[model samples]
Target: MSAHTWGSLDDASARALMEEALAAATGEGVTFADVRLVEAEEERLYTDLRGELDERREHNAGLGVRVLRNGIWGFASAPVDGAGSAAAVARRAVAVAGASTGTAPVRLAPREPTSGTWSVPVDVDPFEVPAGERHDLLQRIVTAASAPGLVRSVTAGLNAKRQHKHYADSEGSRQSQHLVESGAMLLAVAADERGAQRRSFPNSFHGNTAAAGWEYVLGLGLEDEATRVGEEAVALLGAPQAPGGTADVVIGPAQLALQIHESVGHALELDRILGDETNYAGRSWVQPEDIGTLRYGSPAMTIAADPTMPGTRGSFAFDDEGTPASRHLLVEDGILRDVLSSRDAVARHGGGAGSGSDWPGAARADGWAWLPVCFATNVYLEPGEGSLDELLDRMGDGYYADDNRTWSIDDRRMAFQFGTEAAWEVKNGKRGRLLRGFSYGGLTPQFWGSLEAVAGPEEFKAYGMPCGKGEPKQWGFLGHGASPSLFRGLSTGVAR
Candidate 1:
């Protein structure tokens, strides 16, 4: 075997040595082989008036392999330290594959050999920010949250990660890529005579994670959001517990995007339909039989998976399995158009192709990382041709809700509940008093189907968010763009 220094795996000479060892596996009569390595560093900061409880960084990497003979899938993985261990690990994977045959064959659908690497774009790395600045930033938010009748506390922190991957299948295809991501989250807790209330604001720093630096925290600007959230808690202590009655509620981007994510997004994943993901995140209420004909929402409703959207957590040029990122229509004019698909799912559906699911992974001559699953990068609701004021004028009297506080849904993606953190009462075509604990409870179809209007881009904005799925747990960066949308004759009187 000969060595080829494909690329720097985070400045380690070991990367070249591992590549040669994986190359050795190619001649070993194995059915398949590829190589991947992950080297990551992370830091976190937490604060209150008392001080910082956490500040830390860590890294890990490994080579994983998969093989098949006589219908079974086998895998073996270990941390990659040098060239000798790399070749040894590949043999172990072949053994695991043979052992696995007692059950069913690990038959993977065929995919064109893929070869390439992609690096998420970034201007500044988050790790560059000093510890002092980080704490000072969080303290400001806590200070602002102090208000009468309210107890205030602020929690702010950042997470950064850089991943390097290399892949070479049994086919001639060979490729490598580097992806980095970082993000900040601010959690503020408030309480008054009524009860304890909590809300969080998060911002994911797109593809390049830890690279964003400390300056990113200033962008989160907890000081700006804390007071508003704290004020909401105090107001709720005095406001009527969101009188449960039939009245239209204006759901802002935060709440609506989550509704679309949990209901429409997850329902369209083919694995759920094939009965592979029912134990945890619930299966789809909508199915293949419903595509194109399922009246999922109002005729005005349209939604899409947008990997190219800037500053989105889910944005990627190429997925772990080397599939190209793309924008695909999941819904058009309230009709289901497509499901997120993996190489496996795409083939199972009689050669129906995939646009590349979000969280899938591939084998590296060491251990197996998860194949990316279907997920949203920058998901946006197509805006309607109406202004917020115009929509309100049309509504007569109601309230507007913003950002999610509480979310719940049944296993089948239908019948759900949600509570918003910010709200303003609208009366007679104008904004009225501020209110809290605004919840809209209903089935997925009815909620979207009632859509009367959506605010345009001027009203559209992003939710710095975390969208999660899968067992053994994989969390993906997600963006949801929506404007304040209005629904008529809504039922908002639920108590939680």
Candidate 2:
């Protein structure tokens, strides 16, 4: 983490940025206003077989202003420090509200003020290390993947993070936060006389806490895993295609968590359904009337949004608006018990209490951090009965998919399809050789309803990267809490 990215800011500087933003917004005369300062350093190391840096690291900090007036909203943002612009933003938002007139209704749930400064904990800094180490590591992995008719190209990537945030709200919520995250991605591209195929084993670890430093990157012994996975990819080039049918699936944590993130994550968002994000990200299928009544998944499904999980990408002691973070249920017993909501969503829903801080880029933080936008924190789907082996044995003949490629679902979160990097055929209750061009698709509710069993925590692990949502594109780090689990009647086919 030695290479200076956006995570390079001093805490005091960040704090001052927030204090200035809060003072600017409310002072301008608006019903409600918030600011978020997001400082992030994102490093990308893309290497070919020889392991050369295709793209250097990138990082930035930006301020965003979201304001509400007379039941309407407006937003403005720029990279430069627009400290005093909050007043203009507030007024502009009011103008927008007036222009819209009878369009979308406005509402917000009351929230308790939350304030604090938080940072991730770590021992090794990713930027501090030289880029040469990562480059050399990639080369080694690629070289090892070389063998008979098996491998073609290896593109390895290292993603390191340094996030510093400052938040302050009109309601007296003030916070300064810092966190770190690091990840590795290795795509093993292969070829046969037939065609070309690609698979990847991606992993993210270290810096999942509320406080951190350089130590996070060094902690992940990536070199060993690279060699192992690269070799496996070479072998998988000769693997078979997954059979298409209603086969039961035993999924590892990586694939299972992503399913949770896609189907459950987006559908539970309050703003998506309200059409606030329609012009930008798209709306959700879940409606206001569907809350607590829609049966989203199986009776075993118990999902939650928790921001206090410490070093996770989405974990926050207090949200950007100074609303304290909390764990809220999104689904329970196969029913849509709740959807992730911002303070305004809570108000609109007129249900119960909500941490207004749950908003993405939630405003009231430093440097135009952001106002409330719906996002998942840490999502945990309750484990099912039986062990990974038991579930696998029960499957008979199916495919085992790992890691995800491209994925798509309707705005309503109904039918969906995902491309996997690697897989194997589970024939007659046993694991088989690696496979290529693995594909799986299913509907949201039926997929979860088929949940036969979930692996214990020993088999559970965090997947790679953070989840993304919203128009104007606010991406927050979030995780899915799911163990290796099994599902029945999963669909598969060739991807176009």
Candidate 3:
């Protein structure tokens, strides 16, 4: 990390501005108000086999204010100009609140006011590195994966971001946070008359992002893995197709993470369950009455949402709403226990989100310009006993799959299909020939209900990616953790 220290809102000018906005909004007879001052930067670097490079960068600094007036909420945001900008935004927020007249008043679940500051610990700040060095890293992965004849093409890229935020609310909560995240990926495509096949290291989307730094990128070791990625892309071209039928299967961590994300994470958001997202993102199949009663999976299944886990993409000291970080079980022993809840959603449900004190601190916004919404953080299936090999042995005969390629789910986050980039045939408890075009489908509850085994903690791994939701479209960083797991009697098919 550089010798530079990140600025905090407690500094003179920022604190003054935040107080000014709060005073302005509360003066207008609003019951609640909060202001967020944010400064952020994002960098993306891309390269391909031919030694060409492309780069993109974005920087934003702004203040957004949210207010509750006459029981309805209103929001307004603007670029931070000076001392007067915050008060102006606050007044505008109140005016916006006046425009909404007929909706029922909103209520927030009670939470203790918290004051503190936190940041992701990093060995090296990615932004301090030179642009040329970043480009070289991407080029190295592309070069390592290139085989002029068999591997026809290679693409690699890196992403780095840093954001400093200060939040203050009328309820006396004050906090500041500095976060940095970075990651990279490599892809190889091999093609001939038989058609094209591809493989990705880490993941297919954005490879393993986390609330870390340049050290996280180094840990990916993309250059060292590139050769294997290239070889796999070539081998896949000649692999036999996966057969179609109801079958037992073993899912590796890489693919299981995605399954957990799409089917369980989104399906359990409290806002989606309350029908607030129905016009945009579809409502959840889970109803408000389902908590603590619905049999969501097998007795062996358990899932938790935790934003306090260190170094995860979703790990934060406090959510955008100023709620302190929390960990809670969304499902326990196959029963639905809680959903991803916001303060307002929890109160709307009459505090039915979680038993006792779990606040479900899952509300977050994409940036300063958007409104905070209920979103998934680190959602994961709790690991069970046994190694991956042992879990496969228990399966006896099945397909072993990893690396997500394609996914399709209904709007309700139910009844879905997912295709993986590679698979292996398991015969008599031993992995045999390679198989390609592996796909599977099942309803959400039914899919999890079939869970037969989960590898122990040693096999557990967390994967991160961007998940898009909401009407104006905010992409939230989501993390999913899982071990190699076994599922029984899934509807399997050949994708290609």
Candidate 4:
């Protein structure tokens, strides 16, 4: 197929191809089978003090088939061409399945067959925009973030992806989806006798992303935020080192999102709890017996695995497994309630056996070349009743930290240390001197148990980042949402 024609097939054509592949696999004596076809396009642009540093555009299309035979699973994938190629790929997957061995037959929890077409709503398609225009926008952001004397360097960039997927299974389910994601970031660096300090706009680590289009990028207000970022980087050059001691800490949404992602989100993956992901990501500190009884946090903490939130990076109409996306609570009223689960995990963990809990529809593949895994979608903390100001007033004296600088978490995700870009002393409900090198440490449960307050819904924000897992190391973008929150006495100090 021509590069220009990749992912060009209409919904009807893609559905027919998927049905043909599923039929071929079942005819080969496979007990179960599914087919996924994906076509994706991505564009990225980076600009710095010198000018455009890097620009990339990529497009690819492929098909993958998964089959089960004799209690073993097999998967095969290759570039797709004409309609005749689907059957060949399906047969190859069945052959691989037949040659494998398993200790027991594979089982998947039953699900109602579903058929649908879905898409992310976008006011303007990034791909349809001119490359020159994108470059110009990034250049403007970089230029605005540059300071000749104080800030030594500045960098900015934009990244976007458009993916089209069609999925079909032998059980008569058919799903097609189109998703678009866009994000941008700006970074500024300044140096002094102490060391170099950097500041980023919107959020850190390549900024924030959403399942929207160019309108989302435009709404970032990079140009408006640029000067403030530059000024903060310069200000940090002479700031006093953070004091070392146990103290109350208020975390801003930008840093809080990451804290939730590392501590709560990863711990809830059922595969990790069951020890199936120990090699790459390590096992979870949570156990199956702890569900619905463990005091994971304080009453102020509630996290939900929701894939139906519009414009979230992880939002989807149907997961790669053809399961309808839905919202479900993971933690409620300080108790561990549920874990992210796939159909396979549900079957193995007794979720569908009248336990009043079914699969949460968390299955996802990085692309057509990979198989689905139980991964986090839009896992987020539910907003509380107060605002950031109210939290500071409630604390009276403490520290305020924002934007992550560095972090370290144990393999089990039980203990962690996090450093933030900037901090301030909150004395008598008033902000005080700026402090540098703010860092904090605690066990996951203890840290969450300290939750005293969370900002209201208006203050909550969601950020997107690539989450890595699996042996071959597939990375998928996911959203983590949070609001500014206050935690009670915790171990905090200045990083040496």
Candidate 5:
């Protein structure tokens, strides 16, 4: 396929617009201001069992301006055009800020002026791949999962995105970043007199995404996994329901990824704890005072909010606010230590000024049109010294579950229930038979405290998903790195 460019403005042209917009905002006497020009493109293709196909491609380019006046903030965005559009957006943002209401001026943590360019290193840009090749790949995967009459339907798809951003701020920070995200998914469904059963490859929600190219999707081995996924769905139609009562269980990487996201990552965001998200996304069970005091989990648990891990969806050289990316521990040896914080939200930790260390470069925006907010980056559970086999051997007899099927948590992010797409009964330290409708529930702190062992780095995997937050609602792609974990005596049952 012939390569094509997607942006309307070149690097130099977009940078000039950002500079012009920043100058106009500062000229209006705003204490803080920033301008961003973002150009993004996405391609998605889907193939179904009946040889049906759906393809979508989209491209968007826009300029966004954010300004702080009299302690309140305002934002405005417009289609990327010329100097006129930039200046107009900047002026509108300033006016909105001037008319905003706030009891106190926004105080941002100190940050030195920075300038740099960062891009996702990719061997093959997905956009450069031939359209026919992409469609054929998905079709092949779907066909493999057809499974004749046993499998009623099958669907497979691939998605890729490329984004270019030019950013500038009144603080003398100027930077450019290029991002490429690739991912794919496969689903197989089977039906019997009981009900319909479904199975997914890699993950359930849009499969797994990463800050890489088509190489990431190729590495997923969907074509190879498709057959097994179909067989599993058919098997589930007759498998016994998950057992009830308490039992030790091994939580696989995919399920643990979401577990970490809902119970740990979101619960530890500084904004959520400070109640900034209560009106929309709900608040956390953790409190500002809980840091450095609460025992978040067992000593085997260590979690960090790391945005510096290369090739992960959340990894970035700098956040949308120009804060240099850094890795910091959120839970150290099971103790609550820090949080996912931003320069603005960090100051609101308590009535007193919060430390800058609380900020882990977590400020980000969904797109150019959205305002930056405190969001989780790559929150991960640090791997331990045992393999999955070792953990299962250690557990003796119990269950193994992976890939989320259903999950529900309270507004406070405390109590929760999660069901897996597939599970296995463990007998004599060996995986035995598959169990359907497997589910477990527990209180957040109590659940983590039951951790018995964690698989080593060899089993650790990073999974990415789009998380939603904010009043108008915005989606931030986040990564969660996890490994198989052994927990003692979890409450287990069938969903129904």
Candidate 6:
């Protein structure tokens, strides 16, 4: 057998190899099987106050086979050479499945077979950019962030990835896709006797990522924003501690996106509600019986799980299991309407009463090596009728918080607390003095129910990050969209 570079293979060759693997599994008496071939390239650069810290480039190519035998699932993966190697991996997966036991017979919800190709629109591929150019970009961001005398240090970085995948299943679905992603972040830190404060641009955890190329990074205006971040970090060093009391609070889009991620996004996964993810992420407060009747939030709250949104980190034509992507409502008019589910989950627990007949397409794996699971895609709260100024005027007196600093949530995802990097008192419909160490806590449902206003589409924005879940902990990139929103009468205080 001759060795072949999977990345260099054309789409036709890749599909043929996967089809051969599925055929081999069926020949071995496997009830169902699928094969995924993946080729990926990644580039990352990091710089700090001292200048360039590190640079990394990586290339990976592999094939994974999933087989179902006797109602049990088995998965195996290895570097691909040709059709012979693919067949061998498939047989290994089938043999493993034959030896396992399952509590209940496995079944998959019906899905129409699909075949197509999709690619993210890109202006310039990051990999094609010179390494020196990438280094210069990071250095400029760091320089701007460190210009402040009170700034103790600065960190800036850029990350990019390109992936090519071909999937084939026994059900006659064959698909190919090419995806490109780019992200950048800058953090400024200041310290004093009171405590250290930090401010970040775009977002906090790993910054913002999107399905685009070098153009996406250029559009962030990191150099222009770095000085403001540094100044804010220094300003927070002398700001008074946030007054502790019950008061209306306004959350900016950046922090609100994370709030949606921890409280609402994780709680709605069907696997968690059904107890499949209890050990890692904990069971959800949402029970199967609560799907139709549960009051999730105020009528102003509407959340949708959509993968069709352009340029989002979670945008993809089809999931790993060959399910076509579509927009599905998870919450409508504050009513619980749907849950993020895999095909198997839908088969086991039928789409709840009042939920639409369409299957929610959200099954995804971190890569070809991991098994696909029910993961949140681009879940976002729809923008409401008002603007930030209007919402602030309505608040009368409250606090405006933005950019998450710390967050804690219980296993059930019901009770939670979050601290923000910066906040300001709203007095007589205008922002007053800045306050430091501002935090808030409340029950999930009640907290959302307090939502009384949201900024209009002009203020809406989305952020992306790698979300960690599952037993072995697969980190998948996802997106969350939000606008500045106002909540009434929540417990507010300084972090304890």
- Per-candidate Cα lDDT values, in order, are 0.62, 0.63, 0.86, 0.85, 0.87, 0.86
Tens digit of lDDT per residue, candidate 1, span 184-269? 66666676556776656642122122223334545665577767656656666666556667888777776777777777767777
Q: How many steric clashes does model 2 contain? A: 49
* Per-residue lDDT of candidate 4, residues 1-496 (tens digit): 1122335776777777888788789644567899999989888888898894698988888889999886678899887788679998998898889888877787888788899888888888877778778988888887777854678889898899988889999888888888998899888998867779999978885788899988999998888899789888988999998998999999999999899889988898888887889888899999878877899999999998888999988899888888888888889978888888777777777742212335568888989889998788999999987878888888899999999999889878899999999999999878899888999999999999999888899989999878888888888778889888999998998355
lDDT of the structure predicted as candidate 1:
0.62
Model 6 TM-score on a 0 to 1 scale: 0.96
Clashing pairs in 5: 71-105
- Cα-based TM-score, every candidate: 0.85, 0.84, 0.96, 0.96, 0.97, 0.96
Candidate number with the higher TM-score (1 or 2): 1
lDDT of 2 by residue, 1-496 (tens): 3222444456666666656655555423267766666777666667777645686767677766666656667666555344554445444445554565545556555655667766666666766667677667767656654543467777766667676766666666667766676666666666777666665554422113223443543444445655666666666666666666566677777767778877888777776766777776667777788876887766667776766766555666766556666677777777776666667666666643222324322222223445455666677776666667776787778877777766788767778888777787888878887877677787787888887667666666654345556544555666666777777777777464
Tell me the spans in candidate 2 whose CA falls farther than 4 Å from its real position: 1-9, 26-29, 78-105, 147-149, 203-221, 279-281, 352-372, 384-387, 394-397, 466-468, 494-496
Model 3: runs farther than 4 Å from truth?
A: 2-12, 355-357, 494-496
Q: For model 5, how does the per-residue alpha-carbon lDDT over 1-496 read when each residue is reduced to its tens digit? A: 1122556777788888888788779645478998888898988888898888898999988988999887789889988866588988999999888778988778877778889988888888898899888988988898888864789989898889888877899889999888888999998999978899899988887788899988888998888899899988999999989888899999999999999999998999888898888888789999888877799999989998888898888888888888878888889899998888788887666443235543587888977999888878999999998789999999999999998999999889999999998899998899999999999999999999999789999999998888988879898898998989999999998355
lDDT, candidate 5, equals 0.87
Of candidates 5 and 1, the better by TM-score: 5
Question: Which regions in candidate 6 have their CA more than 4 angstroms from the true location?
Answer: 1-6, 27-29, 351-357
Candidate 6, 1-496: lDDT as tens digits: 1112225677877887887788788645467888999888888888898874788988887889998887788888888776599888988898888878889988777777898988888888777788888888888888888788879989898999888888988888889888888999888999878789999988987788889988999999999999899988999999999988899999999999989999998999888888999988898999999987799999999999899998999899998888888898899989988888888887788766423336667788878788888888999999987879888998888999999999999999999999998999999779999989999999999999999988899999889878888989998888898999999999988356
Which has the higher lDDT value, candidate number 2 or candidate number 5?
5
Q: On a 0 to 100 scale, what is the lDDT of residue 106 in model 2?
A: 62
For candidate 4, the TM-score is 0.96
